[model samples]
Target: MSDAIEWVAVDWGTSNLRAWGMSVAGAPISSATSDKGMGKLERGQYPQALQDVVRELGVEDGRHLDVLVCGMAGARQGWIEAPYLEAPTDLRGLAQSSVRPDVPGSTLSVSILPGVCQKRGGENVMRGEETQLLGLASTQQGYEGLVCMPGTHSKWAYLRDTHIGQFSTAMTGEVFEVLRTHSVLRHSLTGENDGAARDAGFGTGASDGLARPQDLLGQLFRVRAASLLSGRDSSWCAGYLSGLLIGTEVAAHLDDIGEAAVPLIGSTSLCALYATVLSMAGKDGRPVDATSVAIAGLSAARQQLA
Candidate 1:
């Protein structure tokens, strides 16, 4: 299988590094992953980390392999800095702007795709998500719509005729984890979520958030207050907090989302959570596989480089 591989595709993020051995036709023939991501590695350690994953994909020693990387591996603190391509940028021709970093003592010919940045309306940037957006465009030719990629930092982007016109981001997941682990709210949200109660709590909290997003600061304390007053369990509290954060995010973007079926590009579970909230607002949330699109996006880049 290694002999059949034409090139390798990689999505090296902060916490994880994922790789795929691609065939000559662009389909992934083999795959591998590692916990040794940009956040964990020093500048000099990137080559070894990447080499380990590439070897796992069955690439032989001394064999020349063209590796296309997207994500934080190209950040300033990453292996080598791949500069940001400012938006209103076309997702196509990403390879044209990609940076080739020297990997001493390795047979890997690595190219890191540049991330996208928004400068006019706000100062915003993205790395791996830009590749996923490119993949979205590859799959849905001439695609134009609002895209939501949910994770630690949820990104909402507008694909205007295959060009990334503008985008906004929300730190929904990271904030939830911080509040749950570090804040006073942790005391009230420290247990496994019970299904029915969690659902009920989520619905109530989502309604409150959607109706009064401006009052988010005021609403947060209510979770703890409700627990102390009514003895609400951890399950309800956790669910409520999650729903509230997500709801507020959705509310902020509601004007852009008017009646359109949003393409939720992320993990299945996270997308489902967003889907539930979109449904509440009588809108559709179409789940698109992040991994598949990432590969597709990388493949699109590979074609250009080839």
Candidate 2:
């Protein structure tokens, strides 16, 4: 298996690390994952954490493999900070700007891909999501449009002919989790969202958010109020909060999105939810596989090594 493996592709995010052993043809033959993500590892511990996962991918001892990594592992507090490539940057040549970290005594030759940043219009930066954009560009030649990568920090980027023009981030997911777990609204949400009642609640919240995004702060408390006054269940509250937050995010970028079909990237469930919200706004939301694009982006980087 090691002999067949040409190189490795890694997406090391804040909470998780995923690695895939690739063949010469750019196909992933074996894969592994670890909880020792950038958030959990100290600077000095990154090498060993990576090495352990690589071993699980069946890389033989003493064998040299080139590992191309993307994501938070290149963060300043991560394994080694890969400087941000400012916006209006071409996603194709991310490998040319990649940094080769010096890991002494390790047989693996690792390169960390730099992330994209926008200084204009209130500074913003992204780590692992850039590679996914690159993958999208690689697969869709000369693509140009709006893309929404939903997660803890949702990113909305405008790709103009494979070059990232500008991007924005929203802490929708993180804020939702915090509000659901820590705020007074926690009493109303049970983390249950799998029924027609939940869907109806989501649609209602999305409609309100889309119509009056500016009133979000004031509308948030309505979840608890609805629960207390109308006897709404936890599922409804959970779905409503999710819908409201995502709707607000979509509303903020409505101008950027226009009437074009937006590509929704991220986990399947999350993408589906975003699609629902976009549908509510009378727009099309096309779901794209986040993992496939990440691998394609990594493969595009590995080719640069050759």
Candidate 3:
């Protein structure tokens, strides 16, 4: 890679695409993102979609552009299909399995990292978040512990050294969305809130409802029934739903976690909710800023290029 050439780091997911243009030192000089995620793009638009960013950034031809990408862009529906590296693979192993985009007539050098997958009891897969996990692990010393990345589908990963040891995924966020919008409990929610009411609701409800995992589904419906029968407040239903899902997630995984306190990585709201849920389960979780981790991960990958 030339010192003057730009290197691009991409984090593409099902619903969003983010790219960064950086110097060889990995300092991001510019960045761009779009709603044109893998889920929304047609098969043939991948090159042009990428080119749109290149063009916007004025990346010139004859200048080698090294690209490292993660996320759903490695999925079957993404720009190119990157195979899954099973657990215990580190950055070097992942880098070895990288897939390049087939942009015909273009001379750009690109490598997409393979998503991590494993089959302990059943098949579990992660695309983009694993890189962020690696990024978090890369910068920290003796980073052996669990990393919980909360999102539309929350993932809990076991990391030892620089490799991913084992992991599991819970559809907590998707379930929450389904319950809030489609289930009978929808009527009781006063819509989403970003304030103390929401926090109080989640904190209280998660503490109470998460304590009884066997009765979760039953108690979930009670949120609706209680509002009608006992005059429970509707405004707290959002928090209640958040609590139920997070509580179930905590219950399902707490036994496997052992004594290590997992660090929660993602948006602040998500981290807050997960931390609150973990607290309810008698565990503590600390939040790691995901954006910083993303940048750091990209930088780490760039170091390999040197």
Candidate 4:
């Protein structure tokens, strides 16, 4: 492999497809994205959408487009299904298991990284974020630690010796979305943007009524009643709702894992909110950018191809 090959790395998810051209040293040269994420594209159009992106960038020669992909693109419904590596898999093992894209008649050489899964008893499975977690472990020091990645479904990963130990996922964000947008709670929640109200709301919800995990459903409904019975501002309910879900997730996982300063890999705002909630629960938290980690990870993986 050449030391200075130009390549593209893709982080294609449910809602967005992002591509970056980087030097062999892993520095990004140019980037482009499209709304052609997996959720919106038809099965047959996947190749064309990818082709369009490459063509727009004038990367027709396969030699110039050494594409590495991660995220939902590795799912069963994606361009090609990359099988999940079991718990305790390292970057070397992950790289060996990557699935190459079969874009017929196209010159672009592509490899989609498989998602990692770890079983923690029962039928629970953790995917997608595990790869990001491994990517984090690959670059950052202190690989043996717990990592909390917040998203539609938040993931808590345990890493040891550069391999995944066990992890769990919580449907916190999805439940929050459903309650706020579809349930009776929507009636109490105003779309108003008030920082003071949000802070107070989050603080109140974060402290009260998170002791019992099973009570989350009931507590969510109370947000509606609290607004109506006490003339609670609806706008504040959004923050309350956020706090409730986060609180439940934290409560469920924190004690079992013991308190260690977990590195959070996600957006800045999300990490900040999570940090705030963790602080409320008396756990130390640090936030790291998953985007930068994604780029770094792809670069690390690309080194294998080189």
Candidate 5:
């Protein structure tokens, strides 16, 4: 049993759930994950699922432990609905909107945090990235700038001194997955995508996409043509496609990024890829660990409740 564990921090998303054993000083002593996520669990199974993950800590003897959770756990279809907090709001407001679910006889005291939403010119909602933004804000000490959290549905958020001003999302990853697996382009792909050849292809495609974004349609079709005509390797094609999508996403929002270095939070590989795009545009990209930020954000929210 972890005697030093003051509370538990969880990041429950669509594909997996990660739980951290945190000390009172905000340090993590142990961590574990479950493949069972919001996508797999029913509305009533959340408590048992989460309860099992942290059961080793021995909190079942009437000594209920505080559990701070972010992400899809707060989704409408998840454990309990913690309505989204609007943008241009302070990060502290996230904890304030947290809802405690009735877990019956569970040994955990859970508070699911509210995600952030943009309701103005566009309609978008994020259930997990908000905690990451809060985590980034906590570390940077009043962080103000644009943050890029790239994934299946990448997020670009603007922050003004720890407050979420506004944000946008891109379906680039989902589109890429669909086209690669279900489209005609699937036949053109062969070989494992990696190494120098892939990078070269990515560079060329990213530069082209950034230069002439309007011709993106024509360029996408060229991937198939290149494979048939020049017998281009599937790895290169994959890299090129990734570069094209990432470049296009970045180019369209170039004006909004300003001249300041944009912070890329989340996956190191994905953030590094975004950093490459930013570099080509004469801007710097600062990479921040997604896990660390999420954990810290949970700690901050927990502290607020304390």
Candidate 6:
């Protein structure tokens, strides 16, 4: 075994490609990222993009670096299709479903992990987030609770003894974007969702959604009406809209969350919002850094290859 470096882990999502070079001991040694993600590149361009980034990171020359990847790079539209593993799966089961893509003339040999799917009630799918969940499972031994990863489409997953039992996706973030940028609600939103506005508007909107989810449609329109009638500012309206959507999703899942606090995995702002909503509802939100968890997950998968 070469003592120089071990393997590389890559998280190739729709918008970005992030990679980490780690030692055999599982400590990260170097890192790189590129804007050329699965969404940005053609199927054939993946090798070059990956090779370029790895080279830029000063990887050992002439070595066939084993690269374990997770995220959309394995999507049907990605470099190679890694089929989805159904719910109630062992978190580490992702690697068993992983697929290796042949990359000619590259110093990297790549294996992309498969995503998880739920086809029960309404159809739902998650790609990159599965890796994070696996990461969560890797570190959170003996943890039995709900994991919420809030993003463009937030995911709520139940972890039973560290295995992923079932999960659901919420379009709360996407819906917030749509209404804020494209709808009449845009007029009431000033594109500013700062802490102050979040404090002022989020609580109110969240309370309304929690109490009366069926009134979401009416409440949505009220953002604009409040701005026009009550002289509400754009920041207030923007925060309110965000809060309302988050509240609706949270309320829907509150019953399932039981007595424990939810472990949240996502960006800081989004996690803060989730924490706020959960706190207001007499629950707690525990933040986990998404990057570290992703690396830990990839490390866990890498261990499987041995």
Q: Candidate 2: where is the Cα deviation over 4 Å?
A: 191-194
Ten residues in sequence with the least summed lDDT for candidate 2: 190-199
| Lowest summed lDDT window (length 10), candidate 6 | 1-10
Residue range with the least summed lDDT across 10 consecutive positions in model 1:
252-261
Give me candidate 5's TM-score against the actual structure.
0.96
Candidate 3: C-alpha lDDT:
0.77
What is the clash count of model 5? 0
Q: By the TM-score metric, which is better: model 1 or model 6? A: 1
Q: What value does the lDDT take at residue 34 in candidate 1? A: 99
Alpha-carbon shift of residue 248 in model 6 (angstroms): 0.9
* 4 versus 5: better lDDT goes to: 5
186 in model 2: Cα distance from truth in Å? 0.8
TM-score list, all predictions: 0.98, 0.97, 0.91, 0.91, 0.96, 0.95
Q: What lDDT score goes with residue 177 in model 4?
A: 87
Residue 136 CA error for candidate 4 (Å)? Answer: 0.9
Instruction: Pick the lDDT winner.
Output: 1
Tens-digit per-residue lDDT, 219-302, candidate 2: 898899999999898888887888898898899988777666788989999999999999888888999999999999899777
List model 3 lDDT by residue over 1-306, tens digit each: 224436888888888788878775667777788777899998788777777766555576556677788888889878789999887678547677788878786667778888988877568999877788778877775778788999888898888767887788888889888887888788887554556666666766677666787777677886787678866566666776787778878887788665667788999988987887787677888899987778777677667656
lDDT (Cα, tens digit) per residue for candidate 5, span 53-95: 8864444445668899999988888889999998878888888
Summed backbone clashes in each candidate are 0, 1, 1, 2, 0, 0
* lDDT at residue 216 of model 2 (Cα atoms): 97
**lDDT to native, each model:** 0.91, 0.89, 0.77, 0.75, 0.85, 0.85
Q: In model 4, what are the clashing residue pairs, if there are any?
A: 1-306, 190-234
